[model samples]
Target: MIRFENIDLAYQGNNVFSDFSLEIAQGEKVVLLGKSGLGKSSLFSLILGFVQPQNGKVFFNENRVDERIVWNVRQKVAFIDQEISIGDYSVSEWLTFVSGIKANHSLSFGGKRLKELMDFFELSRDILNKDISDLSGGEKQRVAIIVSVLLERDVFLLDEVTSALDENLKKKTAEFFVERKDWTVVSISHDPVWLKNPWVKVFDLEKKTWK
Candidate 1:
């Protein structure tokens, strides 16, 4: 559902990507793999329209990604950055605030779903009453992931989401995403937990191509 055709990107005078191209079909789980400074995050930025390509084009569900279509793209995709900060609001307050947003108003993430996700992620129910800023790094990562899933977006852009998580939690998170047959996931991770799954397609930024 996402396609990048001969994309070229640069920062200042340095080139980050040159004639890079990729296509991800619906319900596919793709993991971006490479060392640091290989523009893995920039690929996500390009898809989200946070950064525009100097050449070529990006398309989401057949629509070209540009100023006019970027909003629509954002609505369908849920992005979780490597560093997550959701202000200092309590977990309950934060979730309530997100539910109040116009775009998310139609969706219901009642107590049942919340509890289910928390249980699956091995998070304590007491965390719901804790302030976001007071939570540990791993807790914050799980909370961010839970919030993203609650959005009910079919497409996910996960950037180093399991970086702060332990090995077991990391494996659980990767399995959760890879097992979803109806979701399109593009994850950038250096952890080996994501590599154990044979169904996930691997894209190496070092080679500038997919395997």
Candidate 2:
């Protein structure tokens, strides 16, 4: 449901992408694998309208992603950046605030749902009461993941989300997303655990093609 056509992106005369094109169908799971500076994260920015290409267009579903419909597009996509930060608010407060947002108003954000996701992710229930600043890197990562899942958005753009987790959690997290047949997951990760799932397609950004 995401397509890029002949995209040309650059920063301060440094070109990152040139004539780049890719199409991700609905419910497809793709992983971006490459060294740094390959524009892997830029692809996500293009889809979210955070950045625009100088030449070519980005499309989500059937519509072109432009200023007119960017907000609408963002409402349906969940982007978890490499360095996730929600603010200093307590976990419960953050969830409450997010649930009250206009786009997420319809999604259920209750104690049971939070508890279940926490358990599945091996997070303690007491973490809901802890401030974001108090949580470790791994905890913050898992919490960010939980928030994304709770938003119930079918399209996910995850950037190195498993970087802080232990091996077991990394495997669990990868399996969880890959097993969800209804979700369109595009992730950028150096962790090889994601490659263990035969269904996860790998795109080599440096090569500008799928591996």
Candidate 3:
């Protein structure tokens, strides 16, 4: 349930988007595809209110994404960045800390759910006790993904989420999101694992449109 109406964005002296428009229906899985510097990530920033558009508007679930409603929009959307950073806290401590936040207090993050996600992601339960900084890149990626899943948000903005994972894990990650017909997912990735999924609609930024 996201819509961008004739959006125009610029960075420094360069143009990122010019009269760009797109609409993602509820429960739709759309993948952003293009070479670097095409403003794929900027699209997400526009929707999340991290960057302001010079023209037009962005709407989430019919509400305009502005200062007043941006926080609410963020609370309902799970954003997973390519570089996973959880500070230096141990995994368990980090998860506990985030779960205690006022925004996420209502969601359940019990041991069963934690273990289940770890298993599904091919991660070991022991990782929960490891320091986040000590984990490998791939391990950190899975951990970040686990946090997103535990939040139970219906909308996801995944930016190169599977960049560090092997082929099998990448496929599993793509399948995990694509299979959720009730969830709205907008992902940025170059990995063929996601491109091969029939349910995912590809939006080529080079062409400035969706296929």
Candidate 4:
């Protein structure tokens, strides 16, 4: 379970969101929707503990979201963003490094498991040896998605993850999300395919007053 209680946040005195509240039960798939600047991504960042609200609180599994347990929460959640990890290695090396992270390492997905995931995501075997810079936006997005899926985290925080994908790829990823029997999904998306999905619990940010 997760809760955002009357949260208020701002940047330089400008309101990001105010008096915002929502709850997500385990295994539920939710969508946060509104105009672009209404702090949809900030909501995602808050849940991931990357950003703190100026007031109010965020809770994960009924515990307050704080530094002490943020890492623990992160270990159980996979976040996929459009721009992530433009790095100094080949595509394969990126996977190797991330899988070695403490969170992923504990998941026990070694090279063989990683290869299986890459195959499932439809990544070209050649990408494994290619420089990260050589990958197109779509390829990088797929790689990032594979990384998250391999983590085996039941919860996903996705932000326009399909922005660079074609219709086929979008549906493929959607299928992946749907098949996860225990997934708790919260995504910030404008893609028509995702926005209208009934599996999502919808929240609209436009009705509230900015702080």
Candidate 1: clashing pairs of residues: none
In model 1, the Cα lDDT at residue 97 comes to 93
lDDT by candidate, in order shown: 0.91, 0.91, 0.91, 0.80
Candidate 4 global CA lDDT score: 0.80
List, residue by residue over 1-211, the lDDT tens digit for candidate 2. 9999999999889999989999999999999998888889999999999999999999999899999878998999988999977778998899899999998999988768878999999998889899998899999999999999999899999999999999999999999999999999999997888876798999888877788
How many angstroms is residue 149 displaced in model 3 relative to the true structure, after the best TM-score fit? 0.8
lDDT tens string, model 1, 1-211?
9999999999997898889889999999999999988898998899899999999999999999999999989889999998887887998889999899888998876678989999999998899899999999999999999999999999999999999999899999999999999999999996787766898999888986677
Estimate the lDDT of model 3: 0.91
RMSD of each: 1.1, 0.9, 1.0, 2.7
What is the lDDT for 110 in model 1? Answer: 60
Off by over 4 Å in 2: none
Q: Write the per-residue lDDT of candidate 4 for residues 83-195, one digit (tens) a residue.
A: 86676888777767887886566665457777887777778688889988888888888888887887888889988888888898887787678667689888777676676
Better of 3 and 4 by lDDT: 3
Candidate 4 local lDDT, residue 37: 80
Residue 194 in candidate 2, Cα distance off native in Å: 0.7
Model 4 clashing residue pairs (backbone):
none
